[model samples]
Target: MARPAVRRGAALGLGMLWWWAVLRLAFAPGAGVLEAAVAAGGWGLSVLPVHCVPRAQAAGAVGPERWRGAWRAVRTTTASPLRRSDAGSGPW
Candidate 1:
């Protein structure tokens, strides 16, 4: 189904919510970082308005090749296996 309109509406609602958050913080003194974050998250959740936003499926079934490729990339950048000599290398 075409969802351009739905996406646009959601974006507009989010923008309005962000504006509201700014206004709220401006008017309410002593509203700290945590309070602002909660206000923004709550507003974002309300803007969705749908019971369930359907997730787009993967292109197709995942296969062993995908798994192997993922593992290879992960192994390349990560630290190598720790030998016995390195037992106390890290901070306690």
Candidate 2:
């Protein structure tokens, strides 16, 4: 219950933060799609939940060891037969 809310809040909050930085502000004065994407990726990896991200990036704010157990669950699932094509289907 509360956990899902928290994760959603984190996702929405960080998503706006990232969008503002990459689009509204001068996150990259003259940068193009690639740089904006990379910056967004970095922001996501550092704060957003593992499930909110896509297949391209790694897990956690720092790394796998630092990420919560949920990350491990998703990682293991993504590799198993129970794996879901949708990245958002990570363990809840």
- The sequence of per-residue lDDT tens digits that candidate 2 reaches over residues 1-92 is 99999999998987776776576436447667765775678676878564666534746345545466656567433554655677666666
Q: Kindly report which residue pairs in candidate 2 clash with one another.
A: none
- Candidate 1, residues 1-92, lDDT tens digits: the string is 45998889988887776667777788878667865885778677768857543334435556778889988877454668756765777654
**Which structure among the candidates has the greatest lDDT?**
1
On a 0 to 100 scale, what is the lDDT of residue 50 in model 1? Answer: 75
- Per-model lDDT: 0.71, 0.66
Clashing pairs counted in every model: 0, 0
| TM-scores, each model vs. reference | 0.34, 0.32
